[model samples]
Target: MGIKSALSKPFASFVVKKINKWKYHAVEAQQKVFKTLISSAQDTAFGKDHHFSTIKNYEDFKKQVPVVDYEGLRKYIDRVVEGEENVLWKGKPLYFAKTSGTTSGVKYIPISKESMPEHIKAARNALLTYIHETGRADFVDGKMIFLQGSPEMDKKGGIYFGRLSGIVAHHVPGYLQKNRLPGYDTNCIEDWETKVDAIVEETIHEDMRLISGIPPWCQMYFDRLSAKAGGKKIKDIFQNFNLFVYGGVNYEPYRAKIEETIGRRVDSIETYPASEGFIAYQDSQTEKGLLLLADAGIFYEFIPTEEYFNESPTRLSLGEIELDKNYAIVLNTSAGLWGYSIGDTVKFISKNPYKILVTGRIKHYISAFGEHVIGEEVEYALLTVAKEEGLEVTEFTVAPQVNPEEGELPYHEWFVEFVKAPADMEEFRLKVDQQLQKKNIYYSDLIEGKVLQPLKISMLQPHAFINMMKAEGKLGGQNKVPRLTNDRDLADKLQKYLL
Candidate 1:
């Protein structure tokens, strides 16, 4: 056995034992988390307003606190931003994770000192769980390249602000730091392209064994690395590379391209992490979905996606969740976010282990012609069509073509950037349309009733999506092409760069 594997064996066994126990004790674990959260913040302003002192159990807590989105918590957050103490949590937040906003400027999510450890622990446990399950602890023996946001934070009103990845980069453990790349100076570079160049120069010949990042940016890194190494496959340059830890966006569409770039198969582990919290991770290799982090300092609630927009919606706890139902996730975290809606939709695929698949975003869907098509449906259709046609798609986005000039009926418009275009583009488009209709009955009915036109396909030139993101100043980590939009805004913008 390798030295890394030998050293990690005992810890890996411990992690495996803990995870095995967690599955059976998920309910008790979550209940304890909820109780601790309530007690921790009972003296805060939000807790008082929500009658936290009077709440005794889950039912009482639910009855007292209403489900709210970011906007609903804006007032409290604004106060916290002005350096108010104990406004949301027990004390001031150590930093604020700045994320893309909803139709506004930006969102500042509070990260408390008490909650930071939970975030760090969950992330560490994800890798540990993967190692335990896969028995591949030697992954830690070599360099693990993390393609992330700049570590350099900006201070505003006495609060540090930066991407969650950037913030986490600052806290990487000392032992792991010794095996990580690119260097600190390279990570601190502000521009995406320039930073990528620096990373290539710094780690071109290092003993890289693992890579973790958003799918699109990782693809960019692979392509650049290949180009720099005289067009050789990535595995040729980093022979020890054996694992890919990916998250932040769907990986299905990019899988073929990534595999082709690497020139060989590698074990992949997916995570469901957001700025609010590290929620889930791939625990078992045999499992098809992520194991919900019930024990991880975050209490989860599921609201039926359709009912989420209703005047009143039913919120179901982890025990009440049913398999295969789409739910808009609401979280009450140790970070002092009480009953807050994070806006992402997910569906439970397994119950015993409590595994879930992220379905879509709450605000991200196409409902323009009475046809409610979601991100999951679109992605499934696109991926299915690509696989059937032996095509490779780099990126894609969909929006409704509501204004079709004169008298034409409205249709779903797809802007796709293909690394390998299909031999029969028309056939590929028809298959995608058919697959989408199969996935969504409402879309099929609209097409059958002649209420909507056939799906329109527009192929984008190489680098178009990247250029669009760059122009909008969101070209790197965690920023992805909004898959399905309700309006023509994204489609119209991409049309300017159509091939």
Candidate 2:
């Protein structure tokens, strides 16, 4: 056996044992993690203010600390930025992970020393679990290319700042670094298009076995590789390629396109890593949802999505969550975020193993006229219609058309970029509208009462979404097209590219 395969076998076995232990005692593990986190931060400024010394249990913790978002924690983050020690955590953070924000220009999330290991460990366990479950250790015998953000970091106030992918890339294990592709010089290229070209030139002839990245950007890489190799499928170029690791966005929309590009069915593993923390991962090949990392250096709480926007909402711990109910995730991590709302909504699919599927973002919805349609509902409708019509959607977004001066009632406008357009546009539009109405009753009522007209479709030319992302300087890595918006900010920008 190859060196990597030999090493991975024992490592995979070790990961399986830990995963099984966590699975069987999920609640206990979560409680212990919470206690450990509380004790660790009890002496920090935030902890002292919230009286963490007297906080005895989950009930006391919740009652003392209010659920907060980025804006709510900006004061503490600002202090950290200003080089204040023990402002949030026990000491200054190692770095700040810069991510896109809703109201703020950019969010700088703290990554403390204690919490950084959880990110690396969770990622390692995810791959090891996949290998253990599927007996796919041979995948380690060849090179793996992770299309990540530039690894070169910018120092801000004595702390490094960059995208999470960039930060993680800089910390890849020395052993695996030997098997990674696209040398550091190429990876540090900031312009995505330039970086992709460099990557293609560097890896086109290598024995590449794995590819991992956000779906859309990976698709771009595959497309470029195909063009360079004379329209050859990825499998043809990398004959031993066995796995595709993806995250950052749902894979359903990109599955058909990716498989078509590869020319064969390949195994895929999904993860739920964010700037806030590493949340969950696909632990079992047979399971539909990602297993929650209950014992990681993060404490999790859930608020029902419907109640989240309320002035006061109920917070449910891991032990109290029920299956199939959408909840907004609140995290208190070792990174020093205290009861912070991550803004994403998730639904538990299995309570026994504690597996979850991210449903949508709390602020990423359309309720301009009280219709209240979420990203999940819209994605479901689009995927359903596309599947029935045998079409492949590249990217899409929805926005509200609320101007009566345009001579039509307010309605949801869908801007779609299709890799394979349906033969009949009218049929596609009608099916999408019907499915959405079925998914959301409020949307149905508006259409029925003529408060809103039928949803409108503005077909975008091929690569329009990619071009738009490029123009906005968010072309690659974890960035994605916001699936739904309350206003026309994105829609108006994309309308200029309609076919």
Candidate 3:
């Protein structure tokens, strides 16, 4: 074994043990983080404005500071961009993670010096947790590749600003520097197509082991690798490539096709990360959920998904959250975001040693006909039936088809790209429709009442979604196709790609 591999096993054990202690004391850990954040930022300008010094509890916090999105905090963020000190957090932010939002356009989320390490630590622990549980530290010796944005940045008010993935690229640990592939110049390529080509060239002949990225982009990389080898599977190209690490989107929808490309299934890790914080990671190889990072420099509050927009939604702390119920997650972080709604929804799967599964995004859903179908439901429905049909799906999105040409009822249109299609297209559509009905009773009711017809599947050409993302200038680096849309905007644009 290499020096790094030989050394990581013991370090993994130590980190795992420390994580275990914090996991079990999760509620207490979160409470402590809450107190520390409130105490430390109490003297900042925002703290003074919100009476943070006098706030003693969650109740006081709820009453004093209202929930806000990026636009809601625009004034304070403007000050930060102008190099104002102590405007929100204790001092000037270390960096700004620039991201494009659906409704808010570009956003610059502050990452404090204190909060930056938490992002690094959480990502490191995900791998360490895998090593500790499965005793698989051998891959540490092989070249590792994380497909991410360019490390290039533009400074705003003396703060380095770029995509979150790009910003984190600057901090990859020194030990792994020798093992990480697709060098700085390759990563700095602007066009994603050119960049991914460079990534393939750099790592195609290396002893690559772990490949990490959002699923769709990983799929793109795999496609290039497969083509370069004249149809040889990815496993044949990189025998040591046994682990896939993904976040930002559910992997299940693309799993069948991705594994098909690999010619075998590999162990994978799921993570919950955002511009706001690194929230959780898959901690157990045997378990089903990502362990919540209660000690990760962020305090979490959850509002029931059904009541999220209520004038006073019930906000539950870590100790008060229940199992299997969807909630819109809110963050109060040391990065200067307070009572912030990150727009993602999640469901707790385990309590004491808290663990969660991301259910869907709060805004990304199809409720045009009062049949509110979420990203999770559609994914579950399609994948479940696709498994039965022995088919492989590439990517898909659902949007309401509100107006038919004439004398036709509106329906949910699923634009799907497939690697292997089932024999009977109509039958496959029926099964998927039935599965979705089973998962969502409201959708079932709509079908039965004739308010809407059954869902229709629009088969898309290969690379349809990729082409669409390219046209929208969101081809890579944490950008993903929205799984569900209430409007026809994306659906209409996607129609040209349908077969």
Once model 1 is optimally superposed onto the true structure by TM-score, how far is the C-alpha of residue 470 displaced, in angstroms?
A: 1.3
TM-score of 1: 0.97
Model 2 steric clash pairs = none
What tens digits encode model 3's per-residue C-alpha lDDT throughout 419-467? Answer: 8887999999989999999999999999999989988999999899999
Candidates 1 and 3, the one with greater TM-score: 3
lDDT of each: 0.88, 0.90, 0.91
**lDDT by residue (tens digit), candidate 2, 1-499:** 6988988988899878977888868999989989898898888999999999998999999899999999999998999988888878998899999987758778899998988888998898999998888888887888999999878888777999998988998778988888998898998998889999999999999989989999989999999999999999999999999899989889998999999999998999999999889999998888799999998888899999889889989999999998988899999998999999988999999978899998889989999988789988999999998988788998899999888556678878999989888888887898899999999999999999999988888999989999898898788877888899998899989977999
- Candidate 2: which stretches are off by over 4 Å? 404-407
Candidate 1 per-residue lDDT, tens place, 315-337, comes to 89899988998999999987778
TM-score of 3: 0.98
Q: Each prediction's TM-score against the native?
A: 0.97, 0.97, 0.98
Could you tell me which residue pairs clash in candidate 1?
none
Q: Alpha carbon lDDT of residue 366, candidate 2?
A: 96
